[model samples]
Target chain A: AQSVTQLDSQVPVFEEAPVELRCNYSSSVSVYLFWYVQYPNQGLQLLLKYLSGSTLVKGINGFEAEFNKSQTSFHLRKPSVHISDTAEYFCAVSEEDYKLSFGAGTTVTVRA
Target chain B: DAGVTQSPTHLIKTRGQHVTLRCSPISGHKSVSWYQQVLGQGPQFIFQYYEKEERGRGNFPDRFSARQFPNYSSELNVNALLLGDSALYLCASSLNRGNYGYTFGSGTRLTVV
Candidate 1:
């Protein structure tokens, strides 16, 4: 089984400022990592995923995340955040099975 | 193209009542999964169905059950609801075993009073 741990529960950032949301995972076997964003009263939207290949993965909305094997981390980063970037972000992991285990969400509040 | 669609955006039920939530997977998708998100928490996996068969299950109790239809639509039934059961029920669909990623639907907000 695989599980995700998001370090921060709330992140406040000024508009146009850079932001990073940290995430870590624990799994005995190989795993797949994912980041999802949820707006108010909306479903989760896939930001990016790390299945294989490169450690740095770029996603929609100018967001990106890097998969660190030794650290067992997949942290999300954005060079510049917009007001629209304010939302709830989740980190998830899946092992060989189909089910995904998610971490407690991190709420991002981008202020002007 | 429609993404995963869940029925009854919001519903309220009394304690001890049973509630059923519905979901329609995307076109050509063969797998459907259910999740529950309590306030201020991330979504927790409940169940997964593939090709009309149970594929995976989470740590939920037997009171929480689900089934998938031939059309790849699915229903989640919760028996003897409690205040703790009040949550946002999310439905997600994947082409297969979600090797890539799953498409999620706007969840059904279930309020138990």
Candidate 2:
């Protein structure tokens, strides 16, 4: 079985400041990792995924995440954030089958 | 193209009652999956269907059942609903079952009294 853990439940940052959301996972086999963002009252949108190849994955909206196998971590980062970036972010893992194990989620609040 | 779509954005039901949630996958997508997200928690997978057949099932009770239609749409039926069953039910669709990313719907919020 696979499981994900997001280190923080909430993170607040001033607009234009860099932010990072931490995530870790436990799995016995190779896994595919993903980051998703959910706006208020909206569905989850895929931010990026780490399937293979590079460890650092860039995603839409100027966001990126690095997959660290040894550390069992995949943390999301943005050089700068906008007030509109306030939302909830989730990290998920999928292995072999299509089922996904998700993190508890971290809420990002960007204040002006 | 239209994203994954779910019906009955909100619903209220009583304990021991049954409720059915509907979902329409994106055109050309063959895999449909269901997830349950309770307040302040991440989504938990419930079921996955491909080509109108069961592909995978999560850790859920037998009371939770689902089916896919010929058109790639799906329905999740919950029998004997409990208060704990009250949550946001999400529907996600993918192109295939190869560990690809999924497109999710807005989800149906089911409240059990």
Candidate 3:
């Protein structure tokens, strides 16, 4: 079984400020990592994914995550954020592609 | 080019009642999975179906059952629903049983009173 740990429960940042969301995982076998953003009353939208490639993977909305194999961490970062970036974010890990274990989630509030 | 679509965006039911949620996977998608998201929590895996067969199931009890159709659509049926069953039910679709990432639906909000 695989599990995810999102270290921060909530992150607050001002508009145009940089932010980072930390995530860690533990699994007996290799796994896939993903970041998803959920707006109010909406489904989760994929922010980025790390399958097998360069350690640093980039996704939509100017978000990028580095997959650190040694630390077993995949931290998401954005150099500058906008007010629209305020939402709940989730970090998920999967041993099998069909089953996913998600973290409790982190609420990112981007203020003006 | 529609994404995964779920029916009855919102539903209200009473305890001990049975509820069935529906989902239509993306065109050409062969796998559909169900998840439950309680308030203020992340979504939990419930079940997954591929090619009209059960491929994976979560820790949920037998009271929670699901099936897929030939068209790749799926239905999740919860019997004797409890108050805890009141949550957002999400449906996701993938191209196959492989490592392809999943595309999720908007989800059905099931509220049990």
The best candidate in terms of DockQ:
1
RMSD of 3: 0.8
Candidate 2, residues A20-93: lDDT per residue as tens digits?
99999999999999999999888899999999999999999999999999999999999999999999999999
Q: Which runs in model 1 stand beyond 4 Å of their true positions?
A: none
- lDDT per prediction? 0.96, 0.95, 0.93
Q: Rank the candidates by DockQ, best first.
A: 1, 2, 3
lDDT of candidate 1 at residue A112, scale 0 to 100:
99
lDDT of 2 by residue, B1-113 (tens): 89999999999999999999999999999999999999899999999999999999999999999999999999999999999999999999999973779999999999999
- How do the residues A78-107 of candidate 1 rate in per-residue lDDT, one tens digit apiece? 999999999999999998896889999999
Task: Sort candidate 3 into its docking category.
Answer: medium
- Which lDDT value does model 3 have at A31? 88
Cα deviation at B31, candidate 2, in Å, is 0.2
Task: Please say which candidate is ahead in DockQ: 1 or 3.
Answer: 1
Candidate 3 wrong stretches, greater than 4 Å:
none
Task: List runs of model 2 lying over 4 Å from the truth.
Answer: none
Q: How close is each model in CA RMSD to the real structure?
A: 0.6, 0.7, 0.8
Write candidate 3's Cα lDDT for B58-88 as tens digits.
9999999999999999999999989999999
Backbone clash tally (model 3): 0
